[model samples]
Target: MPLADAGLTAWSWNPLTDIQVMWSYPFMVNAFRAGAVIAVLSAAVGWFVVLRRQTFAAHTLAVVGFPGASGAVLVGVASGYGYFAFCLAAAVVIAMLPGAGQGHGEESALIGTVQAFLLACGFLFVALYKGFLGGVDALLFGSFLGIGDGQVVLLAVVAVVVLAVLAAVGRPLLFASVDPSVAAARALPVRALSVVFLVLLGAATAEASQITGSLLVFALLVMPPATAQLLSPRAAVSLPLGMLIGLAVTWLGLTAAYYSPYPVGFFVTTFAFAAYVLARAARTAATAFGARGPRPGTGATGGTPHAVEEAAA
Candidate 1:
């Protein structure tokens, strides 16, 4: 199931022909399906991640997946179990740790300490699994090759469950994210929602890692959502925009990687980063050009018309 063979060769001349060829292969089909799952799930979950300021947690869960997979391999178990188990465990630990009501410096230090420790554990497991454990880089930066039908099915099931749970709590989750004090005052179960969100984040991180690699899941999970948020003023438009950007990046990256001799994760990450940069630059330019700044407020306060000020004199 070496997907490289299914890719465009020197003989591929026409763009349409190359696409058809890429789509004709079964492995390519699975790759597309898996990539799509990652794209949508990651982006959707990433919107919340951005809102909650939980990128550090997201990255930690992603890195935790590597050790999970490696340890599973060492124990002759499925990697998915290891990934899910470790990520959920990490999320619970993080949720229990002191983040709020503590100094930002102390919280960040604690988070960083957990990250460092996890990375060390991942490397240790990789080192221990000396029997055909595959490349360390490959484990960190995943590949679509050899992905089976069962995995595809499992991925779909996991995604549906995550999205369903998200939908159930969407509004209250939004409230909690924006203003936890108000949400808690309203008796909206804010703490439970925070814990649930962390679990969802872990699930999304693990799932996204299957396609984008453990290290590179941030591309799908952060860049597109961040870009969308920067560009769109309204959450209504921004949330779906992030998913669209993610899907575009995944599709284009997969196609480009098919014709070129590079890993799909590399191309996907590059495309995501490029999109984010372009969005940020465009936002900056618009702000610069659109700034008409500080019209004399009608009464020296904000948002009033600039004219008719002489009456006061």
Candidate 2:
């Protein structure tokens, strides 16, 4: 069934009227509720993902969800269960795989190995299935259709649990992410924190995959947090900034997809990428302009190492 029915009106000059029309539909309402939950959780967890430089691990967990959903279908089970089970399981495996204090090369290799294996398994499941996988496109690219009240409530509950846990560990996780050595020296449970964060990340990834799909989860998972970081240095500012950006892109993507004959993931990913690019350009322009300005305590006008760091910082 079409998310926006034929009876729905086209875009109008009045934004309020347009929104009212969109909200009048049950599917659109559920979609917005689910999207809001996913965006907030993804943004919150993803900020830590970027801060810890664990984008690879996050990507791997996202990929794991595809196999989970496919395998669930192979066994005649609900895909949602498969998504969460596989993602959370993969997260645990990744966490226990000797990552802390390990070389980046080793960590990346391990993560890549898991991602490749799971993705291959996903294809194998698809091949083995006798029935047509009609929802494959929706599984991979996402759709605003079929988001019912139950899914929205489930997503909201999961989001609340994830957010609460994150809040409890927020300070230590931030410290450990910024400087693990010092955090460990201070007797903080750096390893434990890492594991907890990974599990949370996995859950968030699974939830996000339902809306943005396994491939494009990064639209919400990485882009908004990254853009927010580019715009702000302080953790306090960047974390909430990322959440707002996630909400905006998600809502806009849903609205646009509802009106057009396109997938929600594409709109979400494009808007996120555009935001990241704009933030990058603005930061670059500011840095360049600062580089040309006269330095304080010295009359020389040029980009110095300290000057550049100061401007960029």
Best by TM-score: 2
- Candidate 2: list runs displaced more than 4 Å: 1-9, 100-113, 128-131, 292-313
Local error of candidate 2 at 107, Å? 7.7
Clashes of each: 1, 0
Cα lDDT listed for each candidate: 0.78, 0.83
Q: Each model's TM-score, in the order given?
A: 0.86, 0.87
Query: What are the runs in model 1 whose C-alpha is more than 4 Å off?
Result: 1-8, 11-13, 100-104, 107-110, 131-134, 293-313
Which digits, one per residue and each the tens of the lDDT, describe model 2 over residues 175-226? Answer: 9999999999999999999999999998999999988988999999999999
Against the correct fold, how does model 1 do in TM-score?
A: 0.86
- lDDT assessment of candidate 2: 0.83
